[model samples]
Target: MSNTMRILGAPNLYLQGPGAIERIADIVANLGKCALLVADPTVERMLTPQLTKLLTSVGVAFASAPLVGEVTPANVARLAGDHRADVVIAAGGGKGIDAGKAVSRAMSARLVTLPTAASNDGPTSRIFIFYDDDHKLLSAERVPRNPDAVIVDTQILAGAPRHLLVSGIGDALVKRYEAAQCVGAGRPNMFGGRATLAAVSLANVCEQVLREHAVDALAVAGSGKPDESFEKVIEACILLAGLGFEGSGLSIAHAMTRGLSALPATAEALHGRQVAYALLVQFVLENRSAAFMADQFAFYAAVGLPTSLAELGLPKPSADDLRTISSLTHKAPHTRNFERPLSEDELTEAMLQLEQMRQHSAG
Candidate 1:
């Protein structure tokens, strides 16, 4: 691809809805005959039987690889050991799905992601983020292409912990501003090409869908029945956000994840929640208008997303903590995807300013 070329990568087939899982056999059968199923423990207990039954009915031989712990290289290697398959079906949350991706890559097999929760946008994209045994952010590896199929069963998603769906909303909401920042700064997308018009448009629509339906969707989530609003939000969180970030690139909102993961106080928080808080720092760095910041804070409060260091479970961060976060954040390449290069001092100031603004907004 040329330097100026625009790129957009996505799953060849994307499926979502109440019974989307039912279509897995047909989808898998099209891709391969032998399948390796990688699932987290919860998904294994909840959905594996039904999935195996579906695949068995279609005469697709399969083996189960139960994923426990982080998606470390060692863990992925252990999971992939002697379990050859034509395709790997990864089912569950981001870690399990990412593990499946790594396993497929190790075995040189195709990958299909079945996300049980709309927690983040790791499903449709080719990139899979794996961490160390300590849960620190590790290398982000990319497959030759995006997933062959991305199956999102909305009923299963609706049954996920309500906070996870809210976290999805938090994660999806930042695509608009982040994409604009990346494009404005002439940064390459994750694919190392210019952001496509389609990506920018989808990023806008993803934010709009969240703004319109997130509250209503949260109201009905975990009822074990997904409403229309719930479905739209899931699509925004999983597909739109996935495509947007991969095709248009990321900026400060995502860069903050690096720092957040490094800190002990905030490291255990969910990815979407960490990103949501990081978006606030991005707003501060951009010098967003007071009204805009306030509106965002209000939206975050409504959606159960964190708005302050305290809310992120770090009420009183020490100077050393602040330094660690700023230093780590400044080192991230995406931090430069903004309109201007950011200094560690600038990051620290922005975070402190965000805390002040969050306090004022809360009052």
Candidate 2:
């Protein structure tokens, strides 16, 4: 076989520490003189005053905007048109960060991401998953390149809800397995190129670090303390997982997430929480050994990740709901990356199988 071309993409700069956000002035200065800070309502109330004071002290002119809802194209367009700034700093969770990325692209302005939570690996990625008003997955928009910079502050993350950290673990834990599946399937990554050795290796490291330190990280983070384990696991969850998934590829777990968005039952669930349960379904879809599944379920339980449909708020999902999820997943673009094409029937069977194993696994 001919050698496959490999590609990798990453932010121009990445800084992570307990009080990294304190360096906001310096980071923004390097990008431009004027900055537009974007955040959701909650994060805006939490961080805007602090960020504004810091930027003001450094003499950087800046404007602040609050994203009211989902990161839709219309919102991005509004952001690009409403405020004129040299750079855009997206702060908060995934949606806020994604909105900033999209706005920066539309304006052709420089981009910086300051993630307040390790919810998902969205900070360092060039891809943005957009949704409709009802939170249905509409499309995934890819920037021409990754952000100019990504700054993650563990002190901020430590104070976040414990559910967020646990959800991040669920998302990060699947990178290794999904990357391996992509390689086995000979699929192109998000960059539309073959998986690089670096990407796959990082995915391995991501899995190892999470398996070893996730519990410790969760414990300290829940206590509102930034410990070494939180630092390590957050890096694994955000940076490594971001790089690995973008440079390696996506598979069943992520495709299933696209489907989960279709159901109102899962609307309240966080992205990683839904992905957590989807990973078990991915395991079932692969027909993985019972021992492997048990170990995974144990790890999920230890960290309070979602493993059963009940955990995802679908204790008894209707047959119609199951069919809808399966149909959406089957039709998702990412499903084509699987080594074997997954049929809707296969997806339904996997979901059913995972459901059947719930009692047995708990027992």
Candidate 3:
């Protein structure tokens, strides 16, 4: 008989927000006992005390792994083996959440991802970034478990740097187009699987919210207000971006971002920042109407996301580098959904076109 059954369940839930950290006790005590909390030093200092206090209040056994660097294999091995946690609580930004996902999977424990910053969709994802010893990415690792719970309290998310919130909006806005590309290219997602109908619908919702409330939401995030508009944007950043990308599967936009991130110049840009630029490149490569993409630029500009190369803090790639990287991008696991196969020359041209758009827009 063909084994035909798939209904995975999250062992714990994620909780987000300012005072949301204080609720850790209520959420975790009900889930399990011994817990391992993973975060970076800075994030730890910012969010850990509250987490610790909450855990202490609930009488849950716990430990901490303040991840100091990228989630290299060594990092994962060290963390997963060292903590040996029964349940995992990942706090802070995307990196911390991805690292915690790795730790939870490796150690055969339940995971909960808490994001202090709405920087990307990694918080609600089951995939984690993998890296080589030198901190270069290997690829994404697909884990068996999705976090049992995802907790987002608008209060905590709004307090993050406005730039992080802008990046989140950038990351979210590109999903609709990326989903189309993925479908066109026949590319599999992080799971090496196809996109589901549920995923596609989620992506559309994300795009609609982005087009509608991104600026208002971002303003609220920056302004210390949790009004209806602010709450809407936070919801879009978390639930919409989170559920959309994971469910819909990425296409050229994200694939392009992954490829761009491999470049040294773009390596330092935030995930959402990189994703925003990738969307620009896609508009060029796919022959998408500038008028259509112009709205995207407007939305990003309104939110303070860098709409140009100068804003992204990078120089133009040399023709040689662009050509070489473009050739390599074809091999990306997510590129198959693109409408046309990209060549080195085409990729190089796309970069040049983006440069021109940036220059034209700036002037």
Candidate 4:
């Protein structure tokens, strides 16, 4: 409906659920022969048997990149120069996915993302978060190309830690709020400024479904029931949320997250974990009616997500830390759109307020 905006996303297909990776052969049948598989050692070990079996069965050529930590521009530069692979397959959690996207972007190769954990929405996006060797935030760079396909295997996901699944639920919750704010201001941006109405709708639908199904789906994801609620939440988090953020736009919830990562304690947490905590800050900044904010708080509680800074492992971000965060955010491309422009004092207050919420809830 927003003709003034532009919509963009993955070009080919996205598959979800268990055994989805088994179908990778069909998804990238003829694009290339030598495929580069990118993941950390732990994930490589966990997925190698199945991945190798599948690739061999399909007669696909292969190479490998053993991921360490904090994928940087240097890593991308490395992969581009030495890979024998003509295609790139990013597997594992968000970190591995970011690394793989970097390789694909650097090499100008076709990329396919197969997420083993439902921890964050990064798997389907066009931007990859760059970090320093110490895992410090550097910047988030846009891939020259979005993924060709997204392959989600539920069995792989089912095997991931329960904490990650819950984190995914938390990240999924922000879709509606992010989209609504962007639309309300008549502002549109997509992956690097190509926002679209379809993308907004995509995010909206994901948010609603996550709200309705999060509890039940998390139960099923935790247990193994084919809960309708679980399905919707999973789809929204992995599919719609990815499309929405990348194709439509991102605002404060994520902007706040990027800023928070400057603090060492927060950076060590999972991306979804950080985002979930920031969502609470966003709610407070917006000054939503108590009823609305409470509903969101309840959602995080229902999914066992961290809604407070303490829960996110940063109960006491020092004034220096707060100032550092503000400095990082001051010129961040995404900072301009915040409904409430943030200052260091405000961010510091939000951080302390989060600590108070945790203490209040605990006592």
Highest lDDT scorer: 1
Candidate 1 colliding pairs, count: 0
Q: What are the RMSD figures for all models against the true structure?
A: 1.2, 1.4, 3.1, 2.5
List TM-scores for all candidates, in order: 0.98, 0.97, 0.90, 0.91
For candidate 4, the lDDT comes to 0.75
The local distance difference test score of model 2 is 0.88
Off by over 4 Å in 4: 1-3, 192-194, 222-227, 353-363
lDDT of 4 by residue, 1-363 (tens): 245646576647778766787898766656788788888878877777777777877888766778876698887787678776768889888888989888888878889998878888888778888888978778878777677888887766766777888888777778777777666655556644546668878888988887777777766664533445656777888888888877766666777766778777877887788777777776766776667766767777888988776676777667787777666656566556566566767766766665665566557
What are the per-residue Cα lDDT tens digits for candidate 2 across 275-313? Answer: 878878888878899999889888888999988777888
Off by over 4 Å in 2: 1-3
The total of clashing pairs for model 4 equals 6
lDDT score for residue 241 of model 2: 97
Candidate 2 RMSD to the real structure: 1.4
Worst 10 residues of 2 by lDDT: 1-10
- Give the candidate order by descending lDDT: 1, 2, 4, 3
Q: Please provide the root mean square deviation of candidate 3 (C-alpha atoms, Å).
A: 3.1
Which wins on TM-score, candidate 1 or candidate 3? 1
